[model samples]
Target: MSDTSSRIAIVTGASGGIGKAVAERLAADGLSVLVHYSGNAATAAETVAAITAAGGKATAFGGDVADEDAMGRLFQHAIDTFGGVDVVVNSAGIMPLAPVVDTDLDTFDRIQRTNVRGTFVVSQLAARTVRPGGAIINFSTSIMKLQMPTYGAYAMSKGAVEGLTLILAREMRGKDITVNAVAPGPTATPLFFEGKPQEVIDHIAGLNPMQRLGTPQDIAEVTAFLAGPGRWVNGQVLYTNGGAA
Candidate 1:
């Protein structure tokens, strides 16, 4: 990490949803943010604008999360633009669903590439770049424990994310940087509701003791804590699921 006065963060997939919320929340916590998006420049711009309007520092960068060169540049952009990166949040992923038997190989590969490989790419860069006393957060899903039938490949990829989170935390032994995965259950994000019907959504929401779907802000709060003051809470997967499992 480059030496800088202000704490800085790079949030991938920050154009909208939980990523956007986390970016904003971290900015509110006084970190300069680099909001990263895969393709949605307009939405990414909106996130940046919102942050700036709130008197927080932020910039938007566009790149494929799974591309090494692209992600390297994304990390470099934070160094050049924000001085250095103190935190990195890997929240960019795809969640297409299908039972294991019915899922096509291409779809499975795509999910792994984005969710698992993408996290690996960003985590690699973060491991090399994040400042001491920083954090690296990757997103998992509570559905893995729920064992929903159609979530086979998605859950498999996040299982790999959990493995990466723990291994990376240990690998960072003396670095003073914490690594953890946040497993959220039934959040009301665009990705979560894309093709599902209201009844299906309702059913999933009811599985949680809270009897309500999570908002992006709910997960963002957990992320903000991890990125800021939760230093002792490393190498764990926080299930922010309202007792769903």
Candidate 2:
């Protein structure tokens, strides 16, 4: 890690789960993190505290990822506080499972608004504001390849993220910036088992070759590598799923 004291990173959905892990990882890697939470102020504070406690710099901010004005302020906050942003990690997403036919329009629209459009807005802003050698790491899911039942809508949303990451990589060619996506398989996050029973959760843990559910730390390590030393990798979705894919 370089000085990165002035190198800011915006991590959406940073209040918990994968987002929180990625934010902490980036902070430990020396980036000044802008922890973005949608509605959980208390959790956001905890994330900021963890970063600062580790002697890393961080600040918590709240805003709707789907709102353009909110994204503008998010970007502005990073610039105003840390001088400029060098990384943008689009980790805010919701996964509500239902068969395609049974999936209501409202749920479908909500997923798209946050997963696809939110990534677009944030990536667009990053393209304009991020300095040379910056990185934009978008989140996707291995389920897109698995095509599991009841995951059609959710996969569709993450599929859009995969597309955006690839295109944005080429779009930023010659700018010394890299755009990439990381897809984790069956991670053991609170969001992953929201309503599932213990047995269901246990089943998922065994699905991966490692015989365990993926951890947020596993995904965060890959993300940090991409955001830093792995800059040579571009427009690719690195699957860190215990060979499940």
Candidate 3:
């Protein structure tokens, strides 16, 4: 079992952004991490390097999150590398902004495939394989509650994520596993800045009472809690958005 004393985590989409921050934080909290990336091997390696350099343990792995076979292997690989899985953080997602009428069919499908199917695939594997007392943390967006325009497909995808997260928590029964989703509001990550202009960004930032976009670190703190000591906080979508929702 390759020295199973330390807890282990599988953090998808960890090559950058919110995923990366969660990986680093979990490692800092003393869990060995499997840093999963979709296509950015270089950045994934960098994430691994940073962890190891900080006297923490991490490895970079790549695969399509929605691929059942691929993600199944991913779960196995985590067990092989770190004895067993204690946490599975589904931080991999896509955000495409377009009004419902203007959103392309292909784009909507792509968003759902990655955001919804990908989460389902990983969460399914986590449901089956995560060791007792483990945690499965899924990503969602507070934008869904805001009901903003130009986010129809994105919000729909996140709604599915929330539903899957809650039901899976119940299905796990007395397994000692906690399933929950973290819904962040306008975090300052590459994903959030991809299409917004400066003025629009400022306007949205100002809307929050805090008057700023959430940082990746802010969200990571909540994830760390859920993965570690927040055992009673299950089957809930925590709005970790500084009241931005």
Q: What lDDT, from 0 to 1, does candidate 3 have?
A: 0.93
Question: What are the per-model C-alpha RMSD values against the true structure?
Answer: 2.1, 1.0, 2.2
For model 1, where is the 10-residue window of minimal lDDT? 1-10
Give per-residue CA lDDT, model 2, range 14-100, as digits (tens).
999999999999999889999999999999999999999999999998998888899999999988988998999999989888899
Give the per-residue lDDT of model 1 (tens digit) for 1-73.
Answer: 2332399999999999999999999888788999999989999999999999999999999999899999999
Question: What is the lDDT of every predicted structure here?
Answer: 0.93, 0.90, 0.93
* Model 2 TM-score, 2 decimals: 0.97
Superposed Cα deviation of residue 112, candidate 2 (Å): 0.8
- Which pairs clash (backbone N, Cα, C closer than 3 Å) in model 3? none
Q: What clash count goes with each model?
A: 0, 0, 0
**Cα deviation in Å at residue 48, candidate 1?**
0.4
| C-alpha lDDT (0 to 100) for residue 116 of candidate 3 | 97
lDDT of 1 at 43: 100
Task: Tell me how candidate 1 scores on lDDT.
Answer: 0.93
